[model samples]
Target: MAEGILRPLGSSDLRLSPLGLGCWQFSKGRGLVGKFWPVLEDSVIRDIVRTSWEGGINWFDTAEAYGGGQSEEMLADALSALGEAGRGAHVATKWWPIMRTAGNIGKTIDERLRRLKGWPIDLYQVHQPYSFSSAASEMHAMAKLVQQGRIKHVGVSNFTADKMAEADKALREHGLRLVSNQVKYSLLDRRIERNGIMEAAKELGVAIIAYSPLEQGILSGKFHSNPELVKQISGPRKWSSGFKPEALNRTRPLIDRLNELADKYGASPSQVSLNWLIHAHGETVFAIPGASKPHHAQENVNAMRFTLSQEEIGELAELADRSKR
Candidate 1:
């Protein structure tokens, strides 16, 4: 259960473990997005949370769009059942913007709280940059939530460098600061590095929460080792370009390096991938890998047990960069 030091989530007072439990997979088969995962029984949910909690993970990330609050409710139920709620267990949930405007940020605060069963929303994020309202407007609405003690801090997801600036500026106007930006970051998906998001986050002191850090299990090296395994993968990931035979061939070197390091450290390829993610960018990057089962949760925790050397980190980065080209 040993792990790395806790890092700041941004300008917020919350110090988080290197990884958090991504609760999107706990969607319980409800909403549109929830259909991606199978409905987990309450006992299974409890085991996942308990394993993660006992492994030293202090926080969790879920979304309002995830099963339309089914994830939040179930996560809350799991934590409460395990006696971890309100006991250093921070919960972060997002507001689904999509066609909605900033008004909905306030309108739905109670529903979020209602589903959480009075659990404080440690960090509330605007689900995406495509909201009907501007980033400034969304941040302003989130600031109001902070003032009312509805939420502890504000964040955004899938935002560009410029949009992150707008949200930060809006929060600073109200004497608050944008805490984090959750994005689709992984070894295979390094668009944020080439794009301006990484630079802007560092300059603005915003934390980058890397979601899908394992690249939807591609970095786990299972698909590459056993090509036939792809057929068993449910949901849209099988259709993703990364799961294709050629893409697997393309990323073979990076996965090979990950596997080598996994063997060297006595860990799994997914753990090596997750370790590199949280360490490669210093404290600026944190990851939230999903866990459908207790063993997956334990693997996520083990990822924290070892630190990839700087040389190994650079080696993997170079391999990833080459694979992309």
Candidate 2:
């Protein structure tokens, strides 16, 4: 596959690969949420990171809450192992907002910088909107970090449309802009489109950072073809309705369309799904798909090598809309 293209993230000077490597799985199953994934070997983690960097992925997204900050440390270690090769990679990590006031944003920013070995953070985000402090307060804190030169850009995740707008206004008060909103967006989950989030993002000029672009591998057509494989899934995915036989049956037509497109584009079903996202709304959308293995990273980068036709994109969108109804 050819090298992936980099694009501007919202109105920021920071450029990101159309596809980013998500480091949530690097937690190695250590934290409360990390227990859902099987422990991965350090060598495997390094390989995945190395592969992603070499495969043309320039940005990585991780969180402080992911495996209790282990994900940040592991990502740092993996990138450090690359020496000069990883120097230009942009790293985006989030601050967990649960049970904390806006003041905690600055306090935790120090810890996140420490855990990342003092590497510059390209985009620092509030992981979720469930905070004791108001959105305005939290964004003001994030804007402060940007002023301090700790984070290049400020972002948020899982924020509602109104809250996103409020956060943007708050950041503007500090002479900054909310660059992105990271949320779960995929062919299977299109809540952002129905809800006001997508519209707000476009109106506010904030990029939508799409996580789980493959719908936790459902769009890959793995569990649908082999129901037995669903038993081996760990974490919250095992309990997802998408893994159920009936749900799979209901989605068969959509999966079939994805597969058909995959064949036409000479790509995998997951690639087809991810490509759809990056091309969905011009440059307004980006995808961060996790790579548990080296080849997974390679496959993800390859997704950008080809572009889907407008007609093909429309057809897939129609299928997805019908499935939802």
Candidate 3:
């Protein structure tokens, strides 16, 4: 029964689930890759998407850079399986800033549309500010699409406050506004708070779609130990004793606290971390935690099943602050 929590996305007319399933992991495909840096198969991916919808998640985030469009294709694949309800799912996708040419933008959007197979993307965003030229050109292209109704709204990711303001101002010139900036934010990384991205987003009426919201799984408590877990769960890292061990020790206590809290609430560590994010920023903030399994998807959906108290939120914030230093 973890449904009915809808938050306004800044000034946009749209609303989203507190926790949306990210489609980035679908690039790995199934098998050994699925186990170690896994991606679900089409069949399983379909089930997971549907299960997420059943679990009350109405939003999904994907990018063209993920698996060379495999993520979008898989999202489209999942939509083909959902029938009517799938059509209503809010989708947020990105265009690489480097691919900013009008022709290239058309091609990229077409490619994404082909993969999505006509699901009607609710939000389309620029992946990042790759360069000044690409950034400026892509902003215009996004505006053109908004005018043509190919995309519902415009967004940008990995943008700083200055770039966000620039992009917003640029789009506003065309009678449009960038709706969100997807970035890496979690207990481990709060750079947005210092960099003015959060405050600027508040000022500009743009939401922040926090990717890697779990810190590449570091904040999820799964990477608390063993060099192999990092490699197996995260990705291959060059072997170095000093590096891995240090990261482990620093993160261990946080994970321990997360585990303790998880047990008390009967929630997984990932859920706790995401819940913390929800409590940290309220509704304008959303987390997109990817999964390669139905159960993991289920656990992520369970994130909104409980609420943390103000005192607990404060304690976690203090712990995160200490861990940062």
Error of 1 at 177 (Å): 0.6
RMSD each, Å: 1.3, 1.3, 3.2
Residue 144 CA displacement from its true place in model 1, Å: 0.7
Tell me the TM-score of each prediction against the true structure.
Answer: 0.98, 0.97, 0.89
| Model 1 lDDT tens row, 53-100 | 889898999999999999999999888876634377889999999899
Cα lDDT tens digits, model 3, 177-275, are 878888888887889989999999988988888887777667666556445665553344234332366766876777888888999999888889999
Cα lDDT of model 2 by residue, 1-325, tens digit: 1256889999799988999988889988877988867778899999998888888898889999889889999999989988986798889999999999999998878789998996789999999999899999998888888888889999999999999999999999988899999999998898999999999999999999999898879999988788899999877878988788888888889999998988988999999999999998899999999988899998998898899988988888888888766
Instruction: Compute the lDDT of residue 276 as modeled in candidate 3.
Output: 90
**How many clashes in each candidate?**
0, 0, 1
Indicate the worst ten consecutive residues by lDDT in candidate 1. Answer: 79-88
Where model 3 places Cα greater than 4 Å from the true spot, the runs are 28-36, 99-103, 132-136, 225-234, 237-243
Error of 1 at 182 (Å): 0.4
- Residue 128 shift from truth in candidate 1, angstroms: 0.7
Instruction: Judge candidate 2 against the unseen true structure and give its global Cα lDDT, from 0 to 1.
Output: 0.90
How good is model 3 by TM-score? 0.89
Error of 2 at 204 (Å): 0.9
Ranking by lDDT: 1, 2, 3
